[model samples]
Target chain A: MRLELQGVSHRYGDERAVEEVSLGVEAGELVGLLGPSGCGKTTLVQAIAGHVRPTAGRVLLRGEDVTDDPPETRSVGVVFQRSTLFPHMTVRENVAYGLTRQGTDRITACLDLVALDEQRAAYPAELSGGQRRRAELARALAPRPDILLLDEPLSALDRTLRDRLRDEIARIQRETGVTTLFVTHDQTDAMALADRLVILEAGRIAGVDRPRELYHSPPTRFVASFLGRSNSLTATVVGVDPPAVALGDTRVTTPELSGTEDLEPGATVTCHVRPEHIVLSNTGGATPADTGFPDSLRNAEEKLLTLAGEVTRVTDVGHHYDVTVQSETGTALLVETATAPPPPGASVTLGVARDSLTVFD
Target chain B: MNWTRDSRSGYSLERLLPVLLGGLVLVYFAVPFLAFFTRTGVDGVVSGLSTPEARRAIRNSLLTAPVSTAVATLLGVPLGYLLARSSFRGKRLVEAVVVLPLVVPPLVGGTMILTAVGRFTPVGSAAYSVGVPLTDSLVGVVLAQTFVAAPFVIVTARAGFGAVDERLEQASRSLGHGPLATFWHVSLPLAGRAILAGVVLTFARAIGEFGATRIVAYTPQTAPTRIGVEYRRAGIDAVVPLALALLVVTLVVLMTVLRLGQTPGVDPP
Candidate 1:
């Protein structure tokens, strides 16, 4: 079943909460709605679940118009950020609450899916935070709804619990094969769980792509800044032939922009590349004072653009080092390194390839 | 001196002031009830219980008060839910109207009811012609008690329903339960304590109602009305036993209701 929204827009009084937004999710595909807080991801999910009515749009479930259908008729199973398990009821009864006639077989199956079969007789208050979330998941899943809506389901749990439960949800979602829409503000959670991520900005779609694609090729400034740790710097086009842009005192080549032959020189553009792509090496030959047209990046002839900087700070983050370098342009670029980073005040060379950059006007 | 903390155990002068004041107030309140046992011995209570008028009033109050309480709960629970959940224009005004009965004097409410359904009025006459008179009958007593006591249910149940997270309702709805079913299954059960509190308060108010009961249906005397009648015909000494009997009955009922409300996770017997 394909779920689609066409030009969905919702307003709270005169203030718009969700603008003309449209997206589609295929059957059994887990698509994540990712954004910062107050970006209308929840509102969009609500519209799909029929909890909220879009001021102007159509919601189609499997090519059938369900725009006017109430939430009860929409067959959407939702696990809210907070536990919605009926407190007076035991875990088994909570799971079977939506089963129309207290059917126990489906309830047992759903509880087994969340690994909560042993705690069936316990009330919601007796369960831990993660256990309560699992119970809520069982309750929502027992009904076998057409669509499953998870809204920040593991957000309230601790870090270790959140990771474990997020993985659990992903597994359950795959096994159930229900068309699931997971909404979260956590980029890491979205990347880890979603097959595709829809990044929203101020109630509109910023970008929609697979997590890796969006991570490497964010189309907008918001998406670039939101998806991961990226250093954004202003670049002015200094050459059109082979497409080279000036980065502070050095000229860095950008070879990946499509139709770049016609891009005029002196055009101010914004370019961003992830911290891992920015290669920070100890300044062995070129000092901060040593300036040249084409700087040496580890003495390689591969023409990788290099900039001179001094290491400002270094912090080991288990698998990598977060080396903060202050370049001549007064921009602080974060570079991730597997090797031991130089101490503060050591001059370093930051190199990046032409194809690793994302340039936009 | 530590204002909130006391060094002595149960015999400090610091605690004695508030205790003394509380004692004075308690004495002021409890002296009248204390007089019930002192003034009326077991013989008087048994004699009062044996009186035909007192027995009739007790039976009448027991019947009518429960009817009004049941009716109030049936109507007030939904109204409380609506008030707690949704926002519309004049919501504050609607709330004020609902709670007006609690704020206004019961005598004033009784007078208002009397004017609306006093035999000559259109509704009153139509009911009277149809042999369903609203005045000087048990139905009239119930109507008066419902007006005064129903607000207790609305106010407490509103607090209960308000405590329910809206997300729970949304989750229930998304789970294929309509609004009514969601209320019964999710909202009502989650807010049972508050709803039960409201019903208990309504029961207390309805059973003890006197001013409105007198104006609407004085002939079908409730417990309070009988006490008043006995006081006027005889004296306070004669009515102490009846008041004591009413108190015992109310205490037993209140205790049962509170016990039932607290019995969570246990199957209904």
Candidate 2:
């Protein structure tokens, strides 16, 4: 582990901001701390950066305890949510600030790394928001710190600019190969950028796993719901042979229930699956193209638990359509599809793979 | 959309109330200056300013005010920064003490200063036993000016330092600078304009100081003291040139500081 937090907890007077967060980031791997607002993500990052000392526990940087070290000696680079670029200094000067030599070559190289060499002479206030963020990244990276921490780096940007900068950050991080710990509330950014994601809720670690693993099989209810647009359905166990449950009037067998061998018949459980994983098909359409799921998942139709419902709403969300279905039992299930959705009031079939289902008590 | 036309022609009661109220105060402030400039002819001003007493007073004011301002700045800036950034027991009490000179009447403050360091006191006699006298010399004028004006620097610089974003200091610290280095590089530079504004205000206040300077130093007359003496000896007309000179000096300093403060950068919050 390049950076490790050992049972780190912090309190602000009476309020616990971070509660016993223990995690590690591998060398050269990008790990994201994903959470909602005020979930202690920033506080955790601050602790690693030596900005705030944890009330209890230790922070180890490259096997050395840095819990008591000040931020100046920690060798941790941080790009804050707000651009902390010195408004008095030009981009060049800001980048060169942490360098021991104050060499122009090194400053130019860092500026070039962020593609901000052209704006080197401009002050922070003079640059556009994206440019300012890039300059701050360059400045933080210039010192060549042991680890990098990004706290909501792209949260303040507009959707278009955010996508552009997100890609830029990804490219920069890849090129630098610096061990990084990114903190953000945006699921898209975390999923796209991180090698692993740590879900935080109420100042505690909810779950930690690879993005796809966490999305597909979240260990906790909060992680399943917070990671993506998840449709959670209450189901009662009807059989234990293949582990089956009833959703409304429909019966479905989910493989995830196999983990709990002790579950008896009539026991109630929550089944979670992402909206995208729930395939939608317009039953009234003759062509199979109207089937929203890919051919691979469709061919394995027998492996799916199907539900019959009426389309309550169909929202066109650019690249895809978000279709809301109301099952016979009145349970609302959101389905994401690339194909055209059935109009509201049209009959539709929703199919979810048993393996993709995450069941929790 | 037609803001200009509305403001020019509408004159609604709501707008009229503020305009009337604000205009009264504006007129009251301007009238005295208007009368002063118009009543005292340019010849009277030039002749009065050229007099030996007036020249000495002008020289003396120029000498004492800047030194007093420098002394105030040197002593008050660190105290201001401390008051703004640090937490300690009696902080509120210290803040109150910083504002004491500002709230106290200058004559009463001068009397208070006398009790502490008057010629009869230990400090006063000690200084007198040496070559310098604390009460009757130019040092007394400086002491009086600093006592009255130091509060301005302390209060304004405190506000200035307080307005600096702590995050910027944190950023500086993260970039390998320690606390003191962060203060010097980030906090001080960001608070520069406000501190400069305070220094200018102190200078202006120090030069124009009258009541305390009168009580402390009577011989080495500052511009305001000279004006008072001229007014008593001759008339208001005799003092007009000296007053005009002081006004011009103050205006020039104010204008320069305003221009310096307008530089495009991170202003103190």
DockQ for all candidate structures vs. native: 0.64, 0.58
User: What digit string (tens of lDDT, one per residue) describes model 1 on residues B1-269?
Assistant: 54564655655666688899999999998987676568878888899789888889889988998999999999999999999998999999999999898888888888889899988899999999999999999999999999999999998889999998888888888878899999988889778888898998899999999988888888789999999998999887888777887788888988998886773553242
Clashing pairs in 1: none
Q: Name the runs in model 1 displaced over 4 angstroms.
A: A258-263, A284-302, B1-28, B263-269
Report the number of clashing residue pairs per model: 0, 0
Question: lDDT of each model, Cα atoms only?
Answer: 0.86, 0.87
Instruction: Tell me the tens digit of each residue's lDDT in model 2 across B33-129.
Output: 8988787888888888887889999999989998999999999999999999899999999989998999999998888888888899999999999
Residue B86 displacement in candidate 1 (angstroms):
2.1
In candidate 1, position B242 carries an lDDT of: 77
* CA RMSD per model (angstroms): 3.1, 3.9
Q: Which stretches of candidate 2 lie over 4 Å from their true place?
A: A238-242, A258-265, A281-306, B1-26, B87-89, B130-132, B256-269
**Residue A270 of candidate 2: its Cα lDDT?**
87
Model 1: CAPRI class = medium
By summed lDDT, the worst window of 10 consecutive residues in model 1 chain B runs over B260-269
Measured by DockQ, the strongest candidate is: 1
